[model samples]
Target: MKTALPKLEPGYHQRYIIPMMRIGKNGNKLKVFKIRTMYPFSEYLQEYVVGMNGYNTKGKPNNDFRLTPLGRFIRKYWIDELPQVYNLLRGELALVGVRPLSEARFKELPIDIRERRIHYKPGCIPPYVALLMPDSKGNIEAERIYLSEKEKYPHWTDIKYFFKAIFNVLSGKILSS
Candidate 1:
């Protein structure tokens, strides 16, 4: 689905919304829509940024200079992720499950986790939110736990995690990163 995008202010000259290639179910790649939250051409510098600063506890590259000031604000509140609803509607994503990892990040996962991950659709709310573990290590552990439980009780697991994540976000116990 394509829509007309308004021109953003001077520093934010990229299109308002952008398509990101994310790993999806069955190890396929899909275009995920998200509001643009970085300066133009930021995608080209991802490797350099990650190499120099490394990933933060939240698994995002540290000292990312590409984020526009408005981008930072929108990301802080997850407004930048709103356009992902289109993906959800298209059945490429779930309301509650793991966040789709970028190609580089997906490659960093353990072999078993990577195998397990491709079996399910990526979600809007990740397991880390429900588990209250926001660090990189905790994030992986949370996903592992979630995937294990999901294997036994797919629907129930998503239902439980969804509510828990909602509660955590609502109560301010877990802030979006």
Candidate 2:
């Protein structure tokens, strides 16, 4: 939590932490805190980036120039996501479940998935990590699979997926983006 952030221009003061809206439990929107990994005001350029490079396999805008060099490193290591521990503590997230998605990304999901997702808390460790398929389509399918199992056995499903995700990460089968 004490890691140093890169400096912006001399006169520009950067806010190292940012809160982004994500779909939360029961389809409510909530602010989830994250360590900043982009230049200031970069959120305003979402459409521009998408227009230029479009979403990648992971459904993120490709060649997103809004990212700072340090930001890229932070994202790669998931340092930017560390602050979500606060969200977890606040009961907005679970240890294992589908990932919380931004409005744009959430809309891209199929209607059924979208409907089911909101019924459960988003998770820190999503199914993609355990499945080792870190792309948009894979993520949705993995979530569908997970959700199905969760419906049958909620607590047991979480326990199973948690260990799988942990093992995959520790074994270098998956890396955060």
Candidate 3:
């Protein structure tokens, strides 16, 4: 993402710490890195994602406008996440699993739902049916449908897409986002 986002938005530039990270698989705070999508030292960093301040705090969509020409592109196609390959190389994530969420969101999750993710590692994509959330109308409902079939999450529902998505990434089939 650091190498690419600039081509999309010229003025955008930023760095990030993604603070108060949650622990790792071995029970230590995890802090993987990625390229920035906001302006340099953005003021928004001080602002939380969902404002719960306890769990899931890391998932905030701050509505920042610091995107550079390239930054926009990276985010559009989620290319900014490429650097996480280093994390995977180091075993910070799995090829397929539940998406890591803000601490606030994680803490806020219902016990059953939260525990559902405990069996797997965080990863590049979520097991979610993202298409439903595209219109911004069905995140909860989609989650409900997914929850009813909890045994099929990130594994059954996600593995196929994960492979397909990886292939698309390798093949350059989905870009310019």
Top model by lDDT, which number? 1
| Candidate 2 overall lDDT versus native | 0.84
Higher-lDDT candidate of 1 and 2: 1
Candidate 2 residues 1-177, lDDT tens each? 574544445544266877777889998998888888888877666767878887777656888889889988998887988998999998888989899888877888899999998999999888888887787678889999999999999999999999999999888888877
TM-score order of candidates, best first?
Answer: 1, 2, 3
Best by TM-score: 1
- All candidates' TM-scores? 0.90, 0.87, 0.56
Candidate 2: stretches off by over 4 Å: 1-13
lDDT of each: 0.88, 0.84, 0.51
Q: Count clashing residue pairs per candidate.
A: 0, 0, 23
Residue 2, model 3: lDDT of: 46
lDDT of 3 by residue, 75-165 (tens): 7777677776777788887765555554544666566656655555666554343322322223334444544554555456565656655
Q: Can you give the lDDT of residue 120 in candidate 1?
A: 94
lDDT value, residue 48 of candidate 1: 86
Tell me the spans in candidate 3 whose CA falls farther than 4 Å from its real position: 1-28, 41-62, 66-69, 129-158, 163-177
Ranking by lDDT: 1, 2, 3
